[model samples]
Target chain A: MSLILKGFGKVLKNKEILAPINLTIKVNEIVAIQADMEHMNAFLSLVEGKRSYITNEIMMNEQSLQGCEDLFIYRPDMGEYKRLTPEQCIQFWCDLYKVKINIDNVLALTELTHIRNKKNKHLTFSEKKRLQFARSLVQNTSIFIFQEPTYQLDLQSKQVFNRVLNEILKNGGIVIVFTSSLEEGVRMATKVFRLNSRGLQEVELGDEGEKEAEVKEDETDSLIENDTVYQRKFEKISAKSDDKYILFDPLEIDFVETRERQTILHVNNEEFYSTVSMKEIESKLIPYGFYRCHRSYLVNLQRVREVVVWSKNSYSLTLDKGNEQTVPLSKSRYGELKAFLNW
Target chain B: MNLRLIRVLLLKEIKDLIWNGQVAILFVTSILMILVFFTFNQLEFNLPGHSITMFKGIPTTLSFIVLLVTMYVQGNLMVEEKEQNTERLLGLIKVKYINVFISKAIVTYILSYLLFVLAMVIHGYSFENFITASFFTIPFFLMFLFLGTIIAEASSNTIEVSLYGWPIFIVYFVIEGLIYSSIESRFFYLFPNYHIERGFSLIEHGEFLAVFNYIYVPIIWMFIILFFLKKRRKNSKTILNSGFS
Candidate 1:
C-alpha cells in the first residue's frame, strides 16, 4: 500500500506555516521528516486531519484518508493515562481496536513486562515512552506515526524502539516519524526528508562509493611522501581493558577522548583505555571517517548524529551510539567540520 | 454503537473515577450530606407542624446531591481526559467520540441513581415511590450530564471546571428560588432545575399529569444542552493545534 500526499500545505491567518508537501510512503517503508517545532506541528496536524490546509489531499492506497483514519495509529509525544498500568493501557487499546493480540507479547516487545503492573505515573521517562509504544503496537494499524519516538530515552529504551520499528516493518506496516532532530531522523528512518518553509526535500546520504572516493582522495595526499605504498588491510584499534588487550575495528568505536591525560576508547557503551595517544589514533582513523572535533576528542564521523549548538561558544557533537554519547566541539574546529559536511 | 468498545471505555472511566481522590471525596461527602439531612429531619421542633417530614425533605436533598454527583463526576471525567490528552489518544485509535460520551454518561447516571436510592433508604421512603421518582427524574439526570459535558468542553482542567461549573450549579438553586417566589417571569421556566422542582412537587401531590407537563421543559433543556455539546465537540481543538497556534 502506498500513502500519497498531494501538495499538502497549511496557512494560518494568511501567514505560511508549512509549505506544500508532496510525497508517497509505501508499505514496509520507514520515512522520517525533520523540521523545526512549528513546521513539525503544523505538518503533523495536517497529516492527522486535525487542521485544515489551504491545498492538497492525502490518499492511502488510492482512497481518501478523510474517513479511513482508523488505518493510522498516531503516537503523540505524550498522551497516556497515568492511572492505568502498562498492561491495562495495552489491553484498552486492544479492546478499542476490537482486536485480540497477545498482550504479553506486546509488553515483552516494549521491554515493559517487568513494569506491566505498575501505574504509568510511577514509570520513568523511558518506561512511559515504552508504554506509549506498546499501546500503539496493539492497535495493529497499517500506518504508524510516531512523534519523537526516542526523545530523552535511555539506550535500552532506544533499542526497544528499534526492535518495535523492525516488528512493524516485518508486519508490512508503513512507519512515519516526525522529529526536530536531524540525527534522530537519520538514525530511525531509511528515507529521511527535511521539511521547512522551502518545502520538502530528501537528504541525500552519499553512497558507499562516494564515501570511499572521498576517503581515497584524503589518503592519497597524506601518503604521497611514503616511498613504499602498501595495500590496505583490515585494521583494528587496540585498547587495554584491565590486563587484557582488546582489538576493536575502527568502525566499532564511537569516539576517542582523553580524560586526565589518559586516552580512552568508547565502543558501544563500554570504555577501554587506549595505549596510543589521541593524536596518533586520530591520524590512523582519518581514512575511516574519523574527525578531530575537539582538541582531546576524536569522533568517528560515521557515528556522529547531531551537531548540537547550545550557544555561540558552546557546541557538542552527539554520537549515534547507545545512550547517544556526546563530545564537546571546539569553536575553531566547528567551522572546518561544517565545511567538510557541506552544511 | 460497538458494545465491546463501549464496555471497554466504561471500564476505563470506572477505573479512572476510582483512582481519582477528588471524586472519591465528593462521593463520600454526598453520603454524609444525606445522613446530615436525615438527622435534621428527625429532630423535634418547638412549633407544632413546623418540623419537616423526612419524606418531604428527602426529594430536595436528593435533587441537590444528584446535581452535585452528576455534574462533578461527569465534568471531572471529561476535563481529566482533555487535560491529560487521553481524549486525543482515543480519537487516534478511532474510538468513536459518542462511545466515550455514552460511557461517561452511564457511569455518572449510575452514581447519581445509587446516591438517590441510598438517600431514599436512609429516609425510609417506599420502594414504589423510589421507582416512580427515578423514572420521572430521568430528564433532570440527563440535563445535568449534558450540562457537565458543556462545562468540561469549555474548560481545560479541573480548576477551570469548578470555575465554570460551580457558578452554573449555584444558579440552579437561585432559579429554583425565583420559581417559588412572587416573581412572575417566563425566563425562570427555562432552567431545568425549575422544572425539576415543579415535577417533584407534582409527584408529591400525586398529580401525575401535572408532573408530565413539567417534564417537557427539562426534556427540552436536555435537547438544547445536547445541541451545545455537539457544537463544542465539533469545534474542540486538539493538543497539537494549541502548539501550532
Candidate 2:
C-alpha cells in the first residue's frame, strides 16, 4: 500500500501557513520530513485531518484518508497514560485496537520489561518514550508516523527505537517521521525530505563537492610515524559551528573531507568545520581505520558499505550513513584499500 | 455503540478511579458524611417545627454526595487526560467520544448510588420506595454529570476545575436556599438544584407522583448543558489544531 498526498497545504487568515506539497510514501519505505515546529505541526494537522486544507488530497491505497484513519498510527512526542503501568498501558492499547498479542514480548522489545510494573509517571523520559513506542507497536497498523522519536533520548534508547523501527519495516509497514533536525531525518530514513515555505523537496545527501588543499609533507610524515602515541592524546575531535564548539567521538565520524582549504567532519549527513589540518586529522584518525581515499577525502573504513566504480580512474566509496552518501575514491589508493581489507 | 469498546473504556475508568488518591478522598468524605448524619439522627433533636428525620434529610445528603462526587470525579477524569495529553492519543486511536463519555457516566452513576445506599443503611431507613427515589434522582445525577463535563471541557487542568467548579457548586446550594425560603419565582424553576431539592421533599411526603412534576426542569437543564458540552468540545478541537496550548 502507498500513501499519497497531492497538493496538500494549509492557510489561515488568507496567509499560507504551509505551501502545497506532493509526495508518495510506498510500503516498507521509511520517509522523514524536516521542518520548523510551526510548519511541522501544520503539515501534521493537515495529514491527520484535524485542520482544513485550502487545496489538498490525501489517499491511502486509493481510498480517501478522511474515513480510513484507522490504518495509520500516530505516535506523538507527548501523550501517555501516566497513571497506568507499562503493562497496563500496553494492554489498554491492545484492547483499544482490538488486537491480541503477547504483551510481554512488546515490553521486552521496547526494553521496558525491567520496569513492566512501574507506573509511567515514575518512569524516566526515555522509558516513557519507549513505552509510547510499545503502545504503537501493539496497534499493528499499516502505517506508522513518529514525531521526534529520538529527540532527547540517550544512545541506548535510540538503539531501542531503531530496533523497533526495523521490526516495523521488516513487517512491511510504511513509516513517516516528522522532525526539526536534519541529522535525525537522515539517520532514521532512507528518503529524507525537507518541508518549508518553498514546499516539499527531497534532500540529496553527500552531494557536496570537495576541494583539494595543500598539506605540508613534513608535518604529515612525522604524525604518521608516531600515530599510535598521537592517538592516545585525545579521544574526541573538536569542530566548530556558529558560536559553539562540538566534540565528536571518532566512531561517530562517517568521513572527513577538505573544502576550500577548510577541513569538514561529516557525521550523519551534517558537516562541522574543523580547524585541524587534513594531514594531522588523517594521522590522528588512521589508527581508527580511516583511509585517505583521496587527497581531499578521509573516509572512515568502518562506515564504508560499498566501493563503486564509475570508470577505470573514477571511483567513489559509499558510506553506510544514509542513501547515496559517497566520497571520492582516488584510483591510486584503490589497491591500498583492497589490501587493507585483505581482499 | 460497540459493547466491547465500552467495556474496555469502563475498565479503564474503574482502574483510574481506584488509583487516584484524590477521588479516594472524595469517597472517604462521603462515608464520613454518612456516619455524621447517622449520628445526628440518633440524637433525635426535637424543636417545634424543626425536627430532623432521617427520611426528610437523607435526600438532601445524597444529593450533596451526588454533586460532589460526580463533579470532582468526572471533572478530574476529563481534565487529567488533557493535562497528561492522553486525550490526543484517544483521538488518534479513533475511540469514539461517546464511548468515553458513557463509560465515565456509568462509573459516576454507580459510585453515587452506592454512597446513597450506604447513607440510607446507616440512617436505618427502609428500602420500601427505593426504586421511586432512584428514578427521581436519575435526572439530577445526569444534570450534574453534564455540568461537570462542561466544566472539565472548558478547563485545561485540575486547578482550573477547582477554580471554576467551586463557584458553580456553591451557587447550586445558594439557589436551593433561595427557593426553599418561600421566594416565589419562576426563575428558580430554571435551576436543576431547585428540582432536586423539591423532588426530594416530595419524596419525603410520599408524593411520588408529584416528584415527576419537578423532573422535567432538570432534564431540560441537562439537554442545555449537553448542547454546551458539544460546543465546548468543538472549540477544544479548534484550539488543539491551532497549536494554541
Candidate 3:
C-alpha cells in the first residue's frame, strides 16, 4: 500500500503556490516535509478536498484518494478540544469511523491512560497533543497526514510521538508529517522533502559528513559546487512575468521586494512577480546568502558591493548590478551586516 | 442518507449537549423559573375564575425560555467545533453533509423540547394548555434552532455570535411578539413566530386549518435554511462549515 501524488499543484487567487509535483510514500515508511504556514494551508486544503489542484492525481491504498475513503486521515497541528475525556475522544473516533477500538490499548500506546478520565480542557499542552495523537491512532487508515505534529510539544511528549510513529510504521502504515523545523524533520523522517513554490525536493536527513563520504571523489566537487546549500536540482525558484512562467536561480537574484502584498523578484534590472510571501521567500533563500535588510527587502549578500550610510541610524545596501541598485537596510540589522562584511 | 451514520452522529451530539456545563445550568435555571411562576400563581393569584386564562396569555414567555436555551446550546456547539479545529478532521472522513445537518437538528430539537415539556410540568398547567404549548413550541424551537445555526455559521466563535447574533435575533423576536399581540401589519406576519402564535390561536379557537398556516411556514423556512446552508458548505473556504466531529 502507498500514498502517491503525481503532478500535484495548488493555485490560489490566480497564482500557483505549489507547482505541479510528484511524490510517493509507501507503507512502513515515514516522510517528513518542511513548509511554511501558507504552503501548509494550501497543501492541507488540497488534501482535505476544500480546493481542487491543477494536473494532480492522488492515490491511497492503490486507488485514488477520493475513491478510497478509508485510505487516509488528517489531523491539524493545534490541540484545543471541547471538554472531552481522552477515552471519549477515542470512542468518538470509533463511532465516526464505524470501528471498535480497544481504548485501553490506545491510551496505553500514547501514555494517556492515566489521564483518560480527565477532561480535555483541563489537560496541559503536552497532554492535549498526546490525546490528539491517541485519537488519530483509533482510525485504522493506510496513510496519516499530521500538520506540524511536534508543535508546542515538550521533549518528553515528543518522545511519545516518536514512539507512536514507530508503532504505525511497524504496523505497515505510512505517516506524513509537515513541519517547519529542520531538526524535527531530520529526526522523524526516513526521507525528507523541503516544500517550496517549485515543488518537493529530497534533501539529506542524516549526518552531513556521512552522506558526503558516500559520494564518489570524482563527483563530489560537481555535486556541491559552492559552500552554500543550493544544489543544481533545487536552485531554480519559479516566478512569473507578463502572463508567462519564469525561473530564476536564487544565486543570480540581486534582491526581492514586496509591493502591495505582491512579491517581486529583482534580478539583472528585471522584475518578475511572485505569489509567495516575503517571509517564506526569505526562509527559502536565506542559505544562499540572502539577507532581510528591511521588512520589504531581501538582498543577496554576495551582490552587495557597498554599504551607504544615509544617517546615523539609517543605512542601505548598494548591489553590484546595473547602476548599483540600492535597497533599504534596517537599523537593527546594520550590526549583523557590518560584522558579516568585517567592515 | 445512511441511517446508521445519522444515528451515530445524533448520539454524539446528544452526549456533547448533555455534558455541557452551560446547558446543565440553563436547564436548572429554567426549572427554577417554572417553580417561581408556580409559587406566585398559587399564593398571589389563586382566586376563582382565574384558572384557565392564567399563564395562557404569555405563551411567549415559555417561547423565550426555549429560544435562549436552544440558541446557547446549539449555536455554541457549532462554533466550538470550528474554533477547536476539529472540523478539518471530520472533512477527511467522507461523510455526507446532509447526514450531519439532520443529526444535529434532530438532537437539538429533542433536547430543547424535553426541557420545554419539563418546565411546563413544573408550572402545573392543564392538559389542554400543555397540548397547546407543545404544538406551539415544536415549530417555535425548530425555527430558533435554524436561526441559531445560521448565526453560528456566520461567526467565528461564541463571543462573536453573542455579540452580534443575539441582538439581531432578539430584535426580530421582540418585534414578532409585538406584531403577534398588538399589531396588524402584513410585514410583521413574515416572522415565523407571528405565524406560530396565530397557529396556536387557531388551535385555541377550534380552527382546524391552523395546521396549514403554522405548519407550512416552518416547513418552508426549514427547506430554505437547509438549502442556503448546503450552498454555504459547498462554497466554504475552510472545513469548518459542518457541525459533525
Winner by DockQ: 2
- Compare candidates 1 and 2 on DockQ and give the better one: 2
Candidate 3: list runs displaced more than 4 Å.
Answer: A12-14, A50-56, A60-62, A67-75, A78-80, A205-343, B36-58, B122-133, B176-195, B198-235, B238-245
How many Å off is the CA of B201 in candidate 3?
4.8
- Mind giving the per-residue lDDT tens digits that candidate 1 earns over A1-343? 8877787887779889888888899999889888777887887666656443223277678776543354554555556887888888888877777789998999999999999889888999889888877766777577788877877787678778878888888888888898776556655676778888889998643345335644664576567537548855548889998789999999999988765457899888788999876766877899999997765578988988888764454467887745577676766677899999999
Worst 10 residues of 2 chain A by lDDT: A206-215
Docking class of 2: medium
Q: Report how far residue A33 has shifted in candidate 3, in Å.
A: 1.6
B198: Cα error in model 3, Å: 4.6
Residue A174 in candidate 1 has what lDDT?
Answer: 88
| A-chain TM-score of every model | 0.64, 0.63, 0.59
Regions more than 4 Å wrong, model 1? A11-16, A50-57, A60-75, A206-343, B1-4, B48-56, B175-198, B201-210, B238-245
DockQ-based CAPRI category assigned to the predicted complex of candidate 3: acceptable
TM-score-better candidate, 1 vs 3: 1
lDDT against true structure, model 3: 0.69
